[model samples]
Target chain A: MSEADQGAVVDLLGVLAYAELTAFDRLAEDARMAPTLTGRAALARMAAAEITHHVRLTERLVELGADPSAAMAPFTSALDTFHESTRPSTWLEGLVKAYVGDGLAADFYREIAEFLPDPDRALVLEVLDDTGHADFAVREVRAAIAADRRLAGRLALWGRRLVGEAITRSQAVIAEHDRLADLIVTGTGDLAGIGRLIERITDAHTERMKALGLRP
Target chain B: MSEADQGAVVDLLGVLAYAELTAFDRLAEDARMAPTLTGRAALARMAAAEITHHVRLTERLVELGADPSAAMAPFTSALDTFHESTRPSTWLEGLVKAYVGDGLAADFYREIAEFLPDPDRALVLEVLDDTGHADFAVREVRAAIAADRRLAGRLALWGRRLVGEAITRSQAVIAEHDRLADLIVTGTGDLAGIGRLIERITDAHTERMKALGLRP
Candidate 1:
């Protein structure tokens, strides 16, 4: 691969590895907030799936001769801040975050994964694949909203906040990792490519919010 | 399987399922206490392994037509209390708990695993396998103890408390779950078998404590 492509790949994997790590942390903690043991265990299984992805991404990093920890270091703060600022106060909020916020993030990564070379592209796609175990989240959140219509308004606001925080963190990650930015801008052929990338991410986020019965 | 064997199997699977679920909960929470991102990930990965075991046991329970949550419910309080009472206060305490506390519990499960027939016995043995990702814990704790001899005094006490809490809960479980107790007594060919089982578990605990640079 070209040097810039290699750099982009490393940066991408690094950001993703850290995302999985933080996802595990936030979900595991959130599992504790679940109202039922069944709910808690389901959330925990989702948390486990994130670490499973982290293990794979880190393996690829190591294969590329990067220190997994060092590669993941740069993106840790941005991801942590995203989660910290958006900490879910209730089990419902936690489920909404899992479905809406993480769904958007995964869509963005899937977009980037398309711009990569053979094995790396495939690896990125595989790792980013649905952890969409968010089925439980959807069922629970939908039921909560049905039982109390007021929950819909609050959760809709939470969805907006999650998207807002995610965008801010994405920008921070882009500013801090120019190589990653170049991958999106140049890999897709120009500034318009970057525009289209952002647009696609936003569209997907809207669809997810709709799926969760929340207004975007 | 015999009716008694069936009851014994359900009780055993129930206890193990809850054990794995709580292990995941406690380890994930304790991962926060890790001093380094690397250490945190290690603990989180260990926590993830527990959930994997839980998923399998719960699957087996469902195959046998048992409700996973219902099967796990009986031991929830005992397991939760063990964790609640032994919540680690610092990074080192977390590591010690992961090692000594989990190690002893795994030993006990492995002993129980021996008497059951095929698939269930195989499943138990497999689930109880070396979450021995404790190499990290061993190295870290040994180094910390070497650096501060007085720390050993406190940690030794912590280890003892963990064992004490575990024993009290084990007795509570046995008292409450006669089917599980009968499995030990009859499955092992009577009371002497139980004696040998206890002896084996005690011996293993002492060895693990010594390996951690502590007294049994």
Candidate 2:
């Protein structure tokens, strides 16, 4: 890869690394809202899994001769802003955010992975794999919604809000990182290609919301 | 062991399990205070390690035919109170708490492990073994103290406060759990035995503080 390609790869991995770290922090904080000890433990396990992914991504950054913290620093504010704006006020809301919001982010990264070469592609795909807590969220949300049909409307709105915030932050990240934008454009073949990618992610987000008994 | 011994064991494991879970929560919260990404990740790893220990203890509870949540429920408030009272306000304070606070808890658990039967004894010791993040805390705290000699005074008092709160909470727990108190008394063979145990734990805490360049 050329120097420009290396820069793009670092930027991509850096955002993903910082995202995992922020998720770990947020999920752990959200665990406090859980009504049951079992629920809390489930969320804590999810948070722990994110930290494991973070360690891997940072190590990979070091191997690429980029300082992990410096690489991660640039994306911190954008990620923190995204989390801060969508902070969940309840346990169920937190679960939906973990499931719907993170699912959207994972889908976007997986789409971007297609634009990368060899090992980086493989590593990105691997870390983006589900952290095994999705089923728990689905079960809890579906049960809660089933018991009170009115909750569906409120949570559907929350789901939409999460996707909106996620998309806004992601666009800001790509806009600021010229190399990353070039890499995405080059991978997709044109500006329209990026548009197609967002459509696909949005479609997936709707499906995820439906899975949780929330209307898209 | 009789039925009373079994009950004591359950209570003991319950408190320890809850303690680990609370540590995981507090340590993850404290990670947010870290001044650097590396420091943040290090504290996160420590928090994740606590969850691992928690899983083990809870599983052990399950093996004994106890509901893990039920076993952990009884002591949550006491553990939560101990943490709430000593919440760290800064990164250095957080590091000292992780080292000095957690170190003191580990020492107490190790002492109690001796009174446990075979596998419980081994399991407690294994989980209490350093989570591989102690050296990170030691290094950070020592480096900070060296940079500003005055920091030593504040952190030293913090260490003392941690021990004082810990002792008070521990006594409350003992007073409430008659079976567990009886187990300790029986294991020690007398009241003086319990006194000796606390003295040994205190001395270890002092040595730990000295290692971090703080007064006991």
Candidate 3:
């Protein structure tokens, strides 16, 4: 890879590292909202998984001669803003966010991983693997919606808002980092490819919503 | 073991399980206070270890035919109160609490583990094993104290307060759970054994404080 490509990979890894760290933080916080000890433990496990991924990504950055903290610094604000703006107000909202929000982010990253080489691409895909939250969240959310039909409406709205905020912050992050933008644009082969990427992510998000028994 | 003995063991395991769960929660919260990403990751790792212990304990509860959540419920108020009363106000205070506070609690549990049978005793000791937080907390606390001498004084007092609150809540938990109290008394062989146990725990706490450059 060229030096520019390496730098772009670093940027990608850095953002992903910070993203995992924040996800760990947010998931642990959301665990507090769980209605049962079993549910709480489940969310806490997911949080732990995110931290482990964060550690792996940080180690990879160090191996690449990047200062992990310095590399992660630039992307923190955008990610933090994304979480802050979409802060879940209730237990079910939190579940929906964890499921729909994280699923969306993972989908976006997996799309980008198609642009990278060995090791980096492998690491990205591995870290993006589901941390057992999907089935748990789907079961819990579907059950809750079944008990209270009104929840589906609110949660459906919440899911849409989560995706909207995710896309907004993600775009802002890519715009602020030119190397990352260049990598995305080049890897996709054209502006149209970027369009296709968004379309694919949105399609996945709709499928996730439908799985949760919510309107897309 | 007899039914009553089994009940006592269940109570003991319940309290320990809840303790680990709350430790995960507080440690994750405390990670936010860390000054750097490295420090944050360290604390978050410790938090993850706690949750893993919590999972093991909960699984043990299930194996023993006890409802993990119900078994854990009785001790939550006391444990929550202890945490509420000694909530760390700063990063260093948080480190000291993680070190000194958790150390004291672990010491007390180890003393009681002597009465338990093979798997229970082994399980208690294993979950109580240091989660890498000891060295991390010691290094951070001592370094901070060396740089700011005033930290020793406040953290020393903080250490004392942590023990005090811990002792108070522990007594409340014991008083409220007769079977657990019986297990301790029977396990110790006499009431004097309980006194010796407290002394042993206190001594260990003093050693831990000294290790962190704090007054006992």
Candidate 4:
């Protein structure tokens, strides 16, 4: 890999690892808010999957001879800000955060994985959430909305806010890291292609929201 | 199950469920203190296992037509007190707690499992940490002690404090719940038998501490 490409990959891995760590922390805390033990356990299980991803990325960083902490440090503030801005207040909000926020992040990562090189590319692909989680989240959100139609509006707004924060932080990442920006532009071949990828993610997210009878 | 036996079983399940939930919370928090990605990931994996156990216990409560939260509520304060009194101060302390504390708890539960009926018995049996986790904790604690002989004194004291609190609370549980006490006494079939079981647990624990070069 080119020096610039290697740096970008390192940056991406760092962000992903730290994100996983923080997600686990947040979800574990949120699990306490669950109204039922079943709900709590489900959230906890989801959080656990993030830890596994964190381990894989950290291992890859070690193989690359990079200091994982140092690599993760740069994106910590931005990532923390995203989570802080979108901190869920209630059980449903927590579920929305996990279901909607994580769903979007996973989608973005899936697209990005296509652009990464060899080993890192494969690792990213492997870490992405599978269909089971997405389906579970869909069922949960739908059930929650069906229970209280009023929640649909509030959770939809929350989902949109989460997506907005994610996009804002993502743009900041691009602005601060030239190599990362270069990787995206080079891998996708233009801003339009990247924009189209975002559009696809948004479209799927909208369908999910609408399925739950929420405005996208 | 008899009416009284069912109540006692629910009480035990409640205690175990809450313990798993709180352990998940504490371990997730402790993961942040880890100096390396590998260490952090290790703690996170442990946290995940706790959540899995929580799920299994909660499911059993539901199967019994018990309210999971109600079943878990009675022992909340006592368990909380135990953890608060023995909170770890450092990464090494955290590892020691995870190794020694969890080891003792698992041993106690294994003995108690023989008293439970059918599915609950099987569930408790299955929920105990696999040998892999025990080996990991033992290896980590032993390596830490081998590297720093001075840590032995402090860690040994901590281990004793942990056991002291555990036993005190355990006795309180038995004293307050006649059915549970009866279960234990009947399960083992005499004072001497129970004494021998306690001795076996202590011996194993001392062996573990010795392996870590900590004074038993």
Best by TM-score: 3
lDDT by residue (A1-216, candidate 1, tens digit) is 998898889999998998998999999999999888899999999999999999999899999998988998888888888888999999999999999888888998998889899799999899888865888999999899999999999999999999899888898888888888888777779878788888888888888888888888
Window of ten residues with lowest summed lDDT in model 4 chain A: A129-138
Predicted candidate 2 versus true structure: per-residue lDDT over A111-203, tens digit per residue = 998889979999999999986789999999999998999999999999999988888998898899999999988999987987899899989
Q: Summarize candidate 1's per-residue lDDT along B62-145 as a digit string, tens digits.
A: 998999888888889888888889999988889889998988988888887787888999999988888669899999999999
lDDT of candidate 3 over A94-181, digit per residue (tens): 8899899999999999999889998999999999998666799999999999999998999999998888888788889989999999
Q: Report the C-alpha lDDT of model 4 over A10-92, residue by residue, as the tens digit.
A: 98888889888888878988888887656776777888888878888988998988888888888889988998898899988
Model 2 CA deviation exceeding 4 Å by range: none
Q: Report the Cα lDDT for residue B173, model 2.
A: 89
Better of 2 and 4 by DockQ: 2
List clashing residue pairs in candidate 3. Answer: none
Candidate 2 RMSD computed on C-alpha atoms after optimal superposition onto the true structure: 1.4
List A-chain TM-scores for all predictions. Answer: 0.97, 0.98, 0.98, 0.94
Model 1 segments more than 4 A misplaced = none
Docking class of 3: medium
Cα error of candidate 3 at position A42, Å: 1.7
User: Which is the better candidate, 3 or 4, if ranked by DockQ?
Assistant: 3
Question: What DockQ results for candidate 4?
Answer: 0.50
Give the Cα error of residue A116 in candidate 1, in Å: 2.6
For candidate 2, give the lDDT.
0.92
